[model samples]
Target: MAPPLLIFLIMIHGVCSQKENVIYSPSHICALKDSSVIMNCTYTYPTGHQITKVFWTKGPVKGVEPPDLSEDPEYSQRLQYLGDKQQNCTIRLSHVTLKDSHEYYFRFITDKPDVKWTGIPGVTLNVTDLQVESPERVTEGDSVRLTCKSSCTLTDRATFIWYRNSQPLTERRDRNNELLLQSVRREDAGRYSCAVHGHNHISPAVQLNVTYSPRNVSVLITGSGEIVSGDSVTLICSSDSNPPALNFSWFKGGTFVGSGRIYSISKISSDDSGEYKCRSINEHGEKYSDAVTLNIMYPPRNVSVSIIRSCQIWAGGSVTLICSSDSNPPALNFSWFKENESSAVGSGQSFSALQSGRFYCQAHNQHGSQRSDAVTVTVKGHLVILYISIGVVCGAAVIFMMLVWRIRRMKKRNDTHESQMVDSRPPHDRHKACDVELSDPVYENVTADQLDDCKSELDSSVYENLPHNNKRL
Candidate 1:
């Protein structure tokens, strides 16, 4: 047996030697995938022992020498050593992936036989991937929350940033892993992603869909709202909403007129003139546009003239005439014109006629003018009885004259016939008259003279049967 002092000194040397083989390193580390990672380490050994080989190995077992990471096909290309064999055992790994997650050990071999050291409980590397977590859909105006998630806890303190549609949301930087939106609007909806402030690793984007009702509902007229009759008009209903509104209803005043996004009026008339509006509807909700007026204009029509006082005149008197028409924007101007005259006889809706003539009325408006058929008006004196008396007298006088002339003509014709008969009485009748006169010769002197007297009397009687005027000729 050795002395106590020697025994104590030998025990002390063994303790010191055992303590010198220790390796120092972090117990745990978290790193991003597809990125570089560094494992910091240091080691101590006995002063006389010189290291012959230094390398890294993973998942080492007791009583067995593990193969170097550089020798492994999976890690050979990415594993690198950055420290000397004396103390530093730092290593760098390039293009790390989640499959590389494992506990690594730093191993060194001394020049002496059966002399080696391996770090126990070495750095535990955690390879993690980032992902964005969000709800699939949300209604507009509702609060929303999105999170930047990871498969493992990050070793570094991170500041979360958000992105929408590949564009960074500059004001959405948050210390927490979550992004909060109060009363989210439609503009806030898009594909979202997150990242640490200083790291290039960004989470995969998540789509955030937002549903909303119609807004800013309005009707657009293709042209001027004011139109003429028989013209076409178009109105389009427009609104802002998600899943655009497909159903639309049109209204004229309080009545439902049509259905569609576009309301069309072909050959529009005055009856179509009114306040119109449109209702836009969808699965979400509906909205109504403010009313708009569609004005339809037309020319004057159905113009007419009426004699308010007298339609016909018998004597000299004035008559009142009224003009009227049916038209949009009622005819404001009126004119009365006499037939066969180029100028207007009067101007107004009413006219007084003082002369005998046919008159017409014309109604005028901005659109057009129309004329009414002429009406007859007369002015005459009241001398009808006196004129009738004079005509009767003249007619009687003419009848009397014609009767007298007819009588004279008949008397003259009778006389001519009697004279002709006497001549045709033959010579015998005439000789007998002469013989009678001769045989009565004894009475002759007186008789022959008396015959001459009688003959003269007969001639005078014929003249008397003729008209006095004929006797004068």
Candidate 2:
């Protein structure tokens, strides 16, 4: 009984000494997703006990069998046993996933199964991912900043690497954790991410948007060259920008006319002929396109004919008729036509009449033509015969007047002084042609042939509004 008691005392002393020797530091640990981590583990045994094998397990070896972490298929490629017989049981895990979040222990076998030991309250690993923090949207020409963050501090000495659209960005001035972008452009908009220099963990990509004002603005027309009046016309304004332009305005002759990217002028007229442009605007700024000139085509308008004669409209006498019109091309041609005639009588800006007829003129351009109102011309034939006829009529009227005057004088002589008319007349009536002796206007010695000249002068002035003088032959 005394020998047994001494052996029990030795065993008790050995158990207490070994308990103080075994060690596993930092009994708790957390790691980032897909990141490598170091598990600080160590163990010390009595000098006499030889350690033949060392392995790590999920937990304490309760009954018998325990597997090694390095041999497991799930951890074979990623687990590294960086420990040795010197009592260092440290381990390195690469590309750790969430499945690795289990309590772990260290075991030792010195040619005895019972010598195995494990540390309780193992590291608690939480697989968290890195996140990229930045502004979701920014205007062009503005500065931007980006950051890489994790749920917990991975390491104070962690160096960061940035990526744009899955391509490595190596033009960094400083090897810091933040990325600075100055005066960002539209081409700089894309997905961005960051990661530690050598760590497998990377932040999730974040999309970046760059808003910019309109650029490369221009105006487009559906057709080129002359646009005829009363024809449909279309004008379009277009531009490129990061954020699409929301407002479009159209201007003509420096005056606001309409709104929209498309400006349509239906049944275009001559008034629409002018300089036109468009303006594109967005949240950032606005841009204007170069002015474009619009040309409207039209036919001759406000057409009329001029009779350039100061005398009467006569067949024997030469008279000139002029055609005038308003047109864009200045009326390419002019034509003279007689009244009630389908075909033109003459072609040119002016025409001379040698016969009695009704005439009109037309001015023509590329688009169309216009005709003026008609004017009539009359002429006297056989001048000597016209003069003889006028003389006979005047002689008869004069004889009749002489006879009546003789009869009236005889009657007055036969009457006494009291019976006489007394020549009593209103003073106003005495001025009449019949009361006083007057010249006979009917026989002015102007024949019909001469009257033709006077009639022509009147016709020229009255119908054509032509300039003329009242000259009589």
Best by lDDT: 1
TM-score of each: 0.60, 0.59
What lDDT does the true structure give each of the candidates? 0.79, 0.73
What is the model-wide C-alpha lDDT for candidate 2? 0.73
Residues 91-185, candidate 2, lDDT per residue (tens digit)?
88888887787778676777555565544445555565778899999998899998887766653357788889988788862466688899999
Misplaced by over 4 Å in model 1 are: 1-24, 33-36, 49-82, 92-124, 164-172, 224-226, 306-356, 361-370, 378-473
**What's the residue-level lDDT of 239 in candidate 1?**
91
TM-score of 2: 0.59
User: Which 10-residue window in model 2 sums to the lowest lDDT?
Assistant: 464-473
Taking the tens digit of each residue's C-alpha lDDT, what string does model 1 give over 346-432? 999999888778999999988889999999976564534455677799999999678667655654664576467658778667655
Global fold similarity of model 1 (TM-score): 0.60
